[model samples]
Target: MRTQIHSHLQDNQCLELFILEGDASRIRELSHLLNRNIKTVYSKLVSLPHE
Candidate 1:
């Protein structure tokens, strides 16, 4: 997951770009990227778009 997130971040670089790409459910992608469960990631996210 960390590998995937790093790859994605390296490609996106900007949070807005990452969000616009629609690859995630907001910054929870960070948690998701870290191999976190979807529910936990969602719970940690406040529905705000982030990098």
Candidate 2:
């Protein structure tokens, strides 16, 4: 897994990145919980095609 954070020009805001791997079900669950937060400005979930 990888994570990154950067300061936003507005100063009051910032950007965050989280790369998660493992069971798809757990990932989706975690992503859902994160998106439910009122502080999350934007969120997206992307998965690679199954091999």
Candidate 3:
């Protein structure tokens, strides 16, 4: 179950990274661009592997 959740979270982070097109600034800007809570994004990012 933990692995499954981790996989899902990693997938989400990948999707976010793709959407940002490798742009660090735009990735950081996602909070305002997508109107999502930044902490949520940050948490997922930290949970994922570091490539």
- For candidate 3, the per-residue lDDT at 20 reads 27
Of the pair 1 and 3, which is ahead by TM-score?
3
lDDT tens digits by residue: candidate 1, 1-51? 222222333443422212223445554556466446442222233344456
Among the numbered candidates, top lDDT falls to 2
Please rank every candidate by lDDT, starting with the best: 2, 3, 1
- Rank candidates by TM-score, best first: 2, 3, 1
Predictions: Cα RMSD each: 10.7, 2.0, 10.0
* lDDT per model vs. reference: 0.38, 0.81, 0.42
lDDT of 3 by residue, 1-51 (tens): 122223335554633333223555555665455457653544333223337
Lowest summed-lDDT stretch of 10 residues in model 2? 2-11
Going through the candidates in order, what is the number of backbone clashes in each? 0, 0, 0
Model 1 residue 20 lDDT score: 29
Model 3 alpha-carbon drift over 4 Å, by segment: 1-21, 32-51
Off by over 4 Å in 1: 1-24, 36-51
lDDT at 38, model 1: 41
TM-score of each: 0.19, 0.72, 0.24
Residue 3's lDDT in candidate 1 = 21
